[model samples]
Target: MINFNRFFSSLPLLLATLAVQYDEGKTESNAERLLKFGNSLLAQGQLAEALTQFNSAVDNDPKNYMAYYKRATVYLALGKSKAALPDLKMTMKLKPDFTSAFIHHGNILLKIGKMDEAAKDYQEALRQDPNNQEAKTNFESIPALKEHIIDAGQFVKENRLTEAVDYYSRVVMYMPWNVTFRALRAEVYMKEGSYYKAIDDYKSITKLKPDSMAEYLQMSKLHYALGDLEDALSDVRECLKLDQDHKQCLPHYKKLKKLDKQYSQAQEFINGGRYEEAIQKYTKTLDTEPDVPLYKMRSKAKICHCYRKLHKTVEAFKICNEVLEHDEENVDVLLDRGETYLIDEMYDKAIEDFRKADEIENTQRTEEALNRAQKLHKQSLKRDYYKILGVKRNARKKEILKAYRKLAQQWHPDKHEEGPAKDKASKMFMDIAAAKEVLSDPDKRQMFDQGEDPLDPEEQQKRQQWGQPFGGGFNPFGSGGGFKFHFP
Candidate 1:
């Protein structure tokens, strides 16, 4: 009561001392409080909220190993095993002597059937605690887990693909970390004709052993069989990266790259209407090494198409004939060649080709083509000058002249006696002369190529007005008194 100020100051010091004692003995820090809350929430099955608290605990103390492990537990409870993997890894890194973390890690690996990896973790946990019952129990099962692998191999040897696949699948499920089991399962899948499934297994094997070139080559072959050329090419390129001079890989890579490039370019040219360039690219594609039969047929068919588009009927026929020699029932090439013949006004050959194509595949396109060819053939018989001269549409002027001279001598009315034979010869001679007149003259030939007949009554009137001679300067019965020609 006498010194009140001094007593008050002494009271403050006493309170401060009490606060320090409580903090050191019973009171918890903010991080410890959050970790305790997280554990309580985890015990109550409130995983999302427990995860938040654990995250705060880790943030408060970056080196807190327990907080990381708790967060991993929360992740596992949430069915996010992959997400928990990093946290478990970090917990082991921070506190290597934490046997519980090792046990939990081993349990997770065991659930995935990675028995060998789980065994290693269990061994590490045993090393740490020397008395982990969970680690010991799991470690004891690894030998039994490996027995399934032996069974898988036996089934494979017996050629029982279905049973082999089942056994290998069991082994893989129990030993997912084992590359040999995965590869064995993949082989079984291949033998079962489950090619897509085999590819999936090989994809995992390549990831586990990136240096294994054979797995990559196998993947490339599967992709190729599926008609995924780009994917096949990509896998083969990965093989080349592992070993540039690899015997099987190098040749395959070259062939795939060449065919892919050539076919891609040819398609581009065709789309752009560049028939000449497309023809060149398709020809090059056909010549590429390790020749695939389908590829050769495809390239030849495309070449025929390009030539036809360019109105080069002879070239189109040559390429189409090559394809027919191998695949006679190829309706597409038949249609292409038939169209080419139609363009050259070779009606009989066009009709033959179209009818054969229709018989092979009676699609609307083929039926329509057959009908059109039939109709055109009937009309072409009326004024087919090439047929009358007995020369090809692409024959040279010399061939035309030779054919005309031979026919004129054989069918001349003067050569026959004055009887019914002479009457028939007169008619034949007039028809042959008209055929030569149209075919030998370039202007009239151009007109005929445009589907017009210069010797027709209406066309002859036009020729007269244009001062064009109907005989085309060839008079077989003129002053020479025999077959005579004025053309040079």
Candidate 2:
């Protein structure tokens, strides 16, 4: 009763009819038998065996929509959605009214974020089966999602990345499983200078695509940019696990490992109060990796901080300026430089820096530093040895001696008559001598620079008890506590 040769002659047009006739207990084609076997294997969770049967079924009858659809389902079960895409498309082509095929296709498209195309598939599924709840729910949600995606795109085009991130965030919230939208939002967060948030998204993406090395590599770079060297190293280690010899990852891993060790050693030095050693270590880090701007800024800021701790004002100022040239708002560098200025007795400069730092970030530390600097600056103006000698604060011993000699001779009491004129002359002479005494001695000069006048009555008593000379025991004409100006 079955015309076998006629069925073979009209394979494409009669394949479905032939399979359906087999279902009615007539002569069955090999494809129908294989399709049945594949379904049985699929239901038993034997995806590989089912895949083999489905492949044979498709080979026997290329026009079998059910075979293609079954193969696509097997591929989905095996977590091979990409492999299922072509089979899903073929099923749709052979059976345009297949509601399940359209729903499956739309789901894959939605997962991969082909929003408009996914919407069309859902619409077709709804058209075929108006009562399909899944299709109705998905189709109804697409228009609002599409509008959010469109708004995000427009904001990105206009460089309004904050608004773009906001819309992208909304999309991600609606479709948390959509990696594409999450990645898009991550990129916008990066462009908006939200590196930590970008890293958070990338971390989620790694969960979605655990075998993907690119996401780990990107996360490593973000951590490195944010100066989280240890975190950067950890992410790179994840990348290595995914791909042992990844070109960029291996070298980055090595570099980060080296930096971590070096940085930790530098921190140890800092904690131990070995500031010079810390500075050296920090400088080595900078020299070893000067390519990354953020890394360089961090390293140099630390070096500046070390110099501040060492009371090496010149070196601190040099490194601090280098850091500020790149990052003027760097609060750590500003604080370090302010302290450096305070140590160098540049009170006005210290006050200015402290005020600027407080303006940038109003914190208790900065406010206290500002108050201290202001108080010290006001005290500094009261008694300035440099002003008394009419010389700069950084005047060398030779310059200070020269200025003192000139002023002392000009204001000698013997040169003036007794009484008011002589008393004035005596006071001027004593002040000039005290300035010279402090400025000429390195120890006293250091003490004065630190805001403690060695010539103060209290300080002088301490020094006297310690057997140190008062005012270097100035005896111009050679003996006694009296001043005798020789005609030179």
Candidate 3:
């Protein structure tokens, strides 16, 4: 009966102890459950939710190494690589030989562009567990990094530049020490027409390797395309500084210099309204690069226009003629010369030039010249008909007609109004009628062709007096009614 009280008291104490142990076990299980949930979320890319679960697990068991490691992974997933650093270090301290933790820590350092620290972490991971695949892969990846870079180069060549950029970005992210990735990415950026992005990448490359001409040329070309001519000029000059006779860069440098000067002069001339003088300046620009066909053609056209405005037709014609002599098929010069000929009223010459001009295909000036020449030729023919008609040396056809009509009407004096002028008019009229008849006849027209003037009264009288009677001896309308005038 004395041992019952001691037994009861011990029973209660034992029950309490068991309850406390059970509670401790429950707490640890709940913490493990939270950690597992967090890891699942992380693997599924639900980083924020995983972070919440990881934070709960860490709160439940502050010393849980896996919780720390999982929380660090979530941080990395969330792009908070710096935030993951201390958690990784804590994970390593909690479990020193944790191979996966070493890999995660190194990877976080790598994400933050810290290659040396990341390499150390990877090495330590490999040493702790020599057969760890993740550690081995990360370690082996460093030496084969350039091969990855060359793969990216091949991607660029294939014009899979977006994918190439991804590969290059990976190299840049994993091996921040090697700048070739950045440089390669810059080149791809240029190909993609992302000039500003290329400039930024090129700037990084220049910082890494100061003596690279390729970077400078890329930057210059980009600047030029963007119309930042001054910056383009600066970059080209810097490129030349790297290699004085760099063949690729020399042409660009020369082009930029020429463009700069032309832009300045053009602005100046436009503001001054000195168009003719400006044209002259532009003409002089062709001297810098005469082999450029566009420059020569433009200069010739402008100079020709200046001559035209100054009313210097001959000068314009001369220049166009010279150009045509060299390039007979040059449509612009041919059209221009045709117009000049029309302006000079050389209508036949203008028509010929215009016909040649029209034979040139598909030009505005050719059409214009053709139309102008046709119009002027029609007008010229109408204005100057005398050259085609061939009238006489000096005789008035009206005076010749009047004298012949009076002689024919008076020879029959019964129809004539008469006085002392009547007999004279009749005899003179007969001679005049014979003269007019001979001149008008076609056979006498042949006689006139032999240099005889049939309109001369004296020649007509000689022919009448010498005319022979061929069929019969008969009196005709002559000086006497019984006397016949005959000639051999």
Candidate 4:
């Protein structure tokens, strides 16, 4: 009554079940069965099932460290590191020389960024079983820690402070004793705006190693940023003592000394209510450091303050003028000079300086030296063109023209009867012609009034032609006459 095809399919399952039961009953251990099942499941890529079977084997034979190790391997294959870690740890605890378990633990740590711990585990595994290929291979494989340190350096060079800090932290974790690495990381921290973090790192560096000039300098810079000038000065002195010619220390030392002296002198003068004396000392301080633009500006300012205190308007004006000579666009100098002029009842000069100062780009201290002579020229002042021609200023137009003609005729080099006077006469004739043209034209006269030179080359040529003597009575205006006189 059985369906033959169905029966055959069921028959194989039944036989397999019977055989497993027979094997279990024949004094063959459950541990062996669990081990076999685990192997079979593992071969089929059923990691979770294999893990269960191996775990069962371990439970059945707690003394069998191999079962625990195999179970851990399955757990690892399943990507269950938490489960795998504890099991591997236990395997190693059971078999203290379990190199494979230690290596696996290190690998898991590496995956999670616990590089230092991972490295320690790997090193311990290597010590326990130097010839264990898996341990040896893994120990070498955990990323080159030194390379990470170098990567931190590269980040610093590229001005990537945040990235450098991260890489440096990694290096420090693996190499806590590396004082140089700690110091370098601190520098990156400073650049990244974490000054407190930087200080901490610097302190760590000093603690881990002997004191050095570099550490002192770093501390000084931090103190300077924090406005603890006394502490900064102390560190700077220490740095200088260690390396007297250190270029970095020299600038700070000079600056602090100058500031200290200025402060003391200023206080003394100020307490006595001698503002003029205080200003003088400040000015002297500035002169000692001329290359410092700030010093120049401060000195100039102090000079003005001194003059104000002494109520010496003339001296104040002179000082402002000197300031202008040095800085042609100093707004303070310009304003001060303008005020000085106003006090002296020179309104026009004051206005000129004020206008020039307004045109300058405003800054700390600049000069505004107005051309006083040019500014004094009246707008309506007419140029005496006739006088330029050696005629009376009020001479009639006809008389002016006549005077110019006479002068041109007499000085024409082409008609010069003699020597060195010929060159001089040519120049004089050119001048006479130019003056006549400017006087004759109303527009040119106006231009001359505005201080512009107005001379037409054509007028000079025409005068020269007219002035030339007739050679053998030949007229240049008429053709076919004796050789024409060509004025040079």
TM-score of each: 0.52, 0.55, 0.34, 0.32
- What ranges in model 3 sit over 4 Å off? 1-30, 110-116, 140-173, 176-197, 200-488
Worst 10 residues of 1 by lDDT: 479-488
What do the candidate models score in CA lDDT, each in turn? 0.82, 0.84, 0.68, 0.67
Q: What stretches of model 2 exceed 4 Å from their correct place?
A: 1-109, 112-134, 140-175, 184-194, 383-488
Best by lDDT: 2
Clashes of each: 1, 0, 6, 6
Task: Tell me the tens digit of each residue's lDDT in model 4 across 279-384.
Answer: 7787767765556554565566657646644556777877767777777777767777766664454657766877777677543322223433233233214334
In candidate 1, position 419 carries an lDDT of 90
lDDT of 1 by residue, 159-268 (tens): 98898788777667655655777887888888888988998998888776658789889999888766678999999999999999999999989889988999999999
Model 4 regions more than 4 Å off: 1-122, 125-148, 169-177, 186-204, 218-229, 240-255, 287-488
lDDT of 2 by residue, 1-488 (tens): 99999878656435643555467445677898888767766776778978998999999999999999999998888777878999999999999999999999998887767778988999999888999999888878778888999999999999999889989887786577678888999998889889999999999898777676888999999998888888998899999988899998999898888888888999999999998898889888887788988888888899999888877778889989999999998888888899888777788888888889999999999998888877667658766788899986667789998898899889988889999999999888888877776788898787776566776776677778889755444443445534445657
lDDT of 3: 0.68
Residue 216 error, candidate 1, Å: 3.1
